[model samples]
Target: MALTGAGMSTASGIPDYRGPTGSQRKGSPMRYEEFLHDPEGRRRYWARSYVGWWQIATARPNAAHAAVADLQRSGAVGAVVTQNVDGLHQAAGSERVLELHGTLARVVCLGCGAVVPRAQLDRRLRAANPGFAEAAEGVADQLRVNPDGDVDLPEDLVASFVVVLCPVCEVGTLKPDVVYFGEPVPKDRVERAYDLLELAPALLVLGSSLTVMSGYRFVRAAVRRGQPVAVVTDGATRADADGVLKVAAPVQELLPQLVSRLASEPADALSASR
Candidate 1:
């Protein structure tokens, strides 16, 4: 089984939250509770997202993503479970991928439970706030975009930003489908990941710090089951002590070579193996 995280997408132009260079933004991200109860928080989030969404939406899968898909095709990998919300794995042709966190490509209405494409919301936002994208572009060089489609902007700009309501239910707010910092991962997603890990003989971790329990719990469970765990990442990870093999390297640089070597083995043997 393979588990991936934010670092995997860094090569694709999306910045990871906690990397060697540190977080792109200094302050804490908007939490689920704050987003629910505070209209201002929603305004700030959507405004930043309006500017940053283009980065994520236009991002292309890098070598790391392609290598993972190739590994899966070669039968060297059984399943992929990612903490990333980006749809790169699916875009790269990996079939059995499970997104531990929900995708950013979707939005859900808070009141009516209606799910809609993020593109639709983007259109609505663009229509409501004319010339906003052009205005954001003026300061594009001064800010960095984060993995969650948020950008750093001044307080006054955020305060003046307008947030659109869900089209399905005009009175309801629309939120991206991703799991926020304070929100728990859905139980079904956790169970499915556990099931994938339980069946695998070994667990391969790619580009994750594993600092959060959501991803770390699987490493712990694998250790308890006596399954060998290997980790490949650029920086120190929480699971380093438990990992049987730890390689410190960028995923984009390392994965293609790893996949090539793994693909040299007999297909049937590899399929029956790790």
Candidate 2:
């Protein structure tokens, strides 16, 4: 089994939250409670998201993503569980992927439970706020895209920004379908991830710090089961002590090399070892 995270997508122009070059973000992201109860916070989030969404929408899968697909096709990997919400694994033709966090491609209505494509919301936002995009771009000339598809905008701009309500139920608030900080992952999703880990003989971690409990718990579970864990990431990770093998390298260069070596090995040897 392969578990990936934000670093896997860094080469595709999206920034990770806690990587070496991270911390470009000015403040904390909108929390679940803040988003639920504070209209002002919601407005700030949507405004920054509206600008950041273009970068994510236009991003293409990089070599790391393609290598994972190649590995899966060669029968070296059976399942993928990712903490990323970018949808790059699916775009790279990996079918058996489980997104631990919900995707940014969707939005859900808080009141009516209606889910809609994010593109539709983008259209609505564009129509409602004419000239706002250009104005925002002018203010933040070098806006950086964060992992959750949010950017840092001036407070003056954020305060003046307009947030659109859900079209299905006008009274309901529309939020991107992603697990936010201080929010728990859905119970079913967590169970499914555990099921994936339980069935695998070894666990391979890619590009995650494993700092958060969500990803760390899986590593701890694998250790308790006596399953060997191999981690491929650039910096220190929470799983370093538990991992049997830890490779400090950029995934974009490492994954393709790993896939090539695996593919060249004898089928029986690869099956017996993995």
Q: Which candidate tops TM-score?
A: 2
For model 2, what is the error of residue 157's alpha carbon versus the real structure, in angstroms, after optimal superposition? 1.0
Each candidate's lDDT (Cα)? Answer: 0.88, 0.90
Residue pairs with clashing backbones, model 1: none
lDDT of 1 by residue, 17-41 (tens): 7876446666677799999999888
Give the worst 10-residue stretch by lDDT in candidate 1: 19-28
* Candidate 1: residue 124 lDDT (0-100): 92
Clashes of each: 0, 0
lDDT of 1 at 137: 72
Per-residue error for 108 in candidate 2, Å, reads: 0.5
Residue-wise C-alpha lDDT for candidate 2, range 1-274, written one tens digit per residue: 9999998999999988888646776778779999999989999999999999989988999999999999889877879999998899999999799999999999999899999999999999999888888999999769898899988899898887888998987989999999998899999999999999999988999989999999889999999999989999878899877745899999999999988888788999888886
